[model samples]
Target: MTQPHHDGPRTSVRPRPAGDPAATAALTLGVEEEFLLLDPTTGESMPVADRVREALSGTAREQSRQEFRHSMVEMVTPVSPDLAALREHLVALRRAAARAADAVGARLVAVGATPVREAHRTVPDEPRYHDMSRRFGPVAHDPAVCGCHVHVGVPDRELAVQVCNHLRPWLPVVQALTTNSPLHDGRDTGHASWRSMQLERWPSIGPTPHFDSAADYDATVRDLIATGIMLDAAMVYWYARPSASYPTVEVRVGDVCPTVDDTVLVAGLVRALVATAVDEVRAGRPAPRIRDCLVAAAHWRAAHDGVDGDLVDLRTGRPRPAWDLVDDLLAALVPALRRHGDLDLVRREADRLRRDGTGATRQRRIMAGTGGDVRAVLDHLAAQTIAG
Candidate 1:
């Protein structure tokens, strides 16, 4: 189906800023991850969501968004104030999810990308997925890809948009650190993250411009809706956007991390970035204008080289080591890091990635040693699939 078109720019009515200290203090963290269920031996996709749901059975009530029709099952832990608690919750949730999958003759792999995905593995005859396949064609039907999405409560819409803009510079760094999908369709894609590149094909998907205020954002979303370019505000699908359902800014960069520690680290980084951005914006700080081409170029570099890429520092056009830039960000976020009590977790995981390399790197090593056999990579992924 062809998407609708937009004619011209629209006006925005900035919402009156109602800055509340209490609201900001109550900022909480929530995560939504999408994963693929696969046969442990074959590495082919498995349609065992129903069996997994039955496994969860009575426990489903405790987990939010449980019992999915797709081969994937998701869990949302209760809101937590610190990373330690969040870590524990995710660990337990993973175990429950894995146990559910195991009971149904399936296994869960928590990686950014699947090296091989059979299109036929898609949820059989599900209307929603069928409509999605029809709407996005092969993009939605591909059963190999998965992603990690982080949501941080902003309490204010204008602050959410500002957070989205400030987040632009650090996005590539996040992508590089979380790079996992180096192969697609049983072939090496030569890109650090094939998933990131693939998702960019959808309309209005990517980092958007900095809006003046919440009214400006609402007007733009209204225009997109008016033109029928999107079914609703939720369909904006930009890399970062003011979430339609929650009072939070959603960051859709990064692949699914292998460990709960890594997920917590990414979540902490996102929280710090959003908090810092809100402070700067509320204090009347002017944001640097990042040209669309420059942003796209940075994404390409991160996708191609992963940690090996010389990412352009948005603050400075000069190139720097991807690891070096992330270190700087971690240092700059020390205040928010302390606030969230996740500095140690973030630092440790970042150090681990910097030392051993990302999931993509390890997958490539296995493929090279095994003569481009996708099974070798899947074997490793399956071993890690048993939840922490």
Candidate 2:
């Protein structure tokens, strides 16, 4: 099916003056991760999410739910005030989901997309899924991917709208760090994040638009809904948005990371970013005048190179090494990090991720060592998924 033509968001980014450094505070945060249910011996994805959910203990079941694909299940951490608590919650959830999948004779893997040789997973029996499948054909059927979503508490939707702009440039940086879907359908896709490529195929998925206020955001959303480009507000696939069900800013960008440490690292960065953005907004600073096409270009390249190649330096409009951008982002967030007691964690993990490389880098290394066997990649992913 041909997707409707909607040029992402044409809202003009207005220039804002540099203002005083405002107060920063650590925000309560949560994480939602999706995992693939695979046949342990065959390394093929299976439509067994319901069985895994049934096998989960009551508490674990409460923290988990089904994703778009029946071969996938998602687990969410409770609201956490610190990275330590976030790590504990994420680890427990990963273990619980892994144990449940094992009980149902499957392996749960934290992959952005299935490395299995086939794409045959089914959707759950739900009205939303049925509507999506009927409306979009294979576009809905073939999304065989999973992602990690982080929610950082904000005071209000208006503030969340403002913070979204502050987050625009940093989205690509985070994507570069968590590029897990380097291979798809048992073959190398060339792009470090094949999942990102598949997702942007949707008409509404891309950079978040600049908004004048919360009312402007709501009106634009209504206009887009009237265009029939999206089913509802929930379908707006911008990299960042105000939560529909909670008072928080949700950054739904990165892939499902391979381990609890990765999740915590991402959480620390996201929380620090949100906190930093909140400070900027309260200080009367306007959002940056970044072009939509430039943001799109950066995102595409980030998906292509992960952290191994150069990226467009938006500040200078020139190419720079990807890890340099990551470092600059870390440097910008130091104040927020210090306020949140995450300075040490962020510094240490940034060095480690840079040294160890991203998930895509690690997956590529595994393929090389195993003579390009996709099955071994899945095996390694399954092992790492719950190792924390």
Candidate 3:
């Protein structure tokens, strides 16, 4: 990727006047969700992603790509200007992928990790993947994990990098809202998002540091590359980063959600966060200055308990109920959501999520109801994956 001029993101792009959402076309959003191909009976990952990929047609085939493991595949939505359109696109794509999986005798499960252990660890035949496996060894096992990535368009690369700075603290709260992986390797991990824990095995995966400017961000990336820890810029697994290819900021903190509604809620909140941050940047406001360890603690707490337990609120450095932090996040983003015409959608879905609880809580409930049968949880996930 060619480096662009770094004059700061706010040099030419000022805060928008309070106007219709349609007037601000640059805020278009996209989502990418990774899924696992599982054996319907055993719930272990099936190494038939190539067959499923071949079966996909139309939009699903066009927008989808293979993940590192042969048991995994990723489907991305097209750039959507509104939450409703994003929902429609996600529904269609997921349905198409599910159909393809069925045709190949595999069940596509929208989950962060398989309930049962996958012994195969089938790495793809691609050269880059082979190199990764050779270099990283056991760390390559982490790619078996799935995640939901949200991409929000910005005016330029500079703006996207700066937005990531403002987004540092909020990533943990958002991660808690979408926690889905509770059972892993046929056992309850006692953590809401086991996938989040799995991801940290990779050297590059963690909280993004606050960058003073795009130049500062670029310098850090170069230094990491020089250390030979990461293969390239694309390998930096920060919670959020400026897109390597698109003029957008991609937030990769949340685990892949169970249903379309959960995914949509994540996208709406993330975009609103980015919009609010952009406004502050244009207004010459400073980003939050909590210590790095506190931000990491917040992330760890979110992964451990999700919505079922307390989170360390960064403001006071004290633990608060997870729900309270979620509500505070919503309150902070209301103006941005309203400006983007997504206020009602976000609010409604948030209430529903609160009532239904995080995916981890639901999984635990099912585990108890079924007398500790892990297969039952997989069955529930299979049905929810294509329920749209």
Local distance difference test scores for all models? 0.71, 0.85, 0.86
Best of the candidates, lDDT: 3
Q: How many backbone clashes does candidate 3 have?
A: 0
Which run of 10 residues does model 1 get worst, by summed lDDT?
1-10
For model 2, the superposed segments whose C-alpha errors exceed 4 Å read: 1-23
Question: Is candidate 1 or 3 superior in TM-score?
Answer: 3
Runs of candidate 1 exceeding 4 Å displacement: 1-26, 58-69, 121-132
CA deviation > 4 Å runs, candidate 3: 1-26
* lDDT computed for candidate 3: 0.86
**Cα lDDT of model 2 overall?**
0.85
- lDDT per residue as tens, model 3, 1-388: 1223455433333454545453334388999999999988888888888899899987789999988888888999999999999999999988998899999889988888767878778588888888888888888865378899999998577677778888987888999998999888788999999998888788788888777677778787998889788888889788999988778899999989999999999999999999988877666566776787888899999999998899988888899999999999999998889988999999999999999988888889999998999989988988898887
Looking at model 1, residue 358 earns an lDDT score of: 81
**lDDT per residue as tens, model 2, 115-173:** 76545645778998888777777788784788999999996777889889889878888
Which candidate do you rate higher for TM-score, 2 or 3?
Answer: 3
lDDT of 2 at 208: 85
How far out, in Å, is residue 324 in model 1? 1.8
lDDT (Cα, tens digit) per residue for candidate 1, span 264-324: 8788888888877776666556567677677777877887888866787877766898878
Candidate 1 global lDDT: 0.71
Worst 10 residues of 3 by lDDT: 1-10
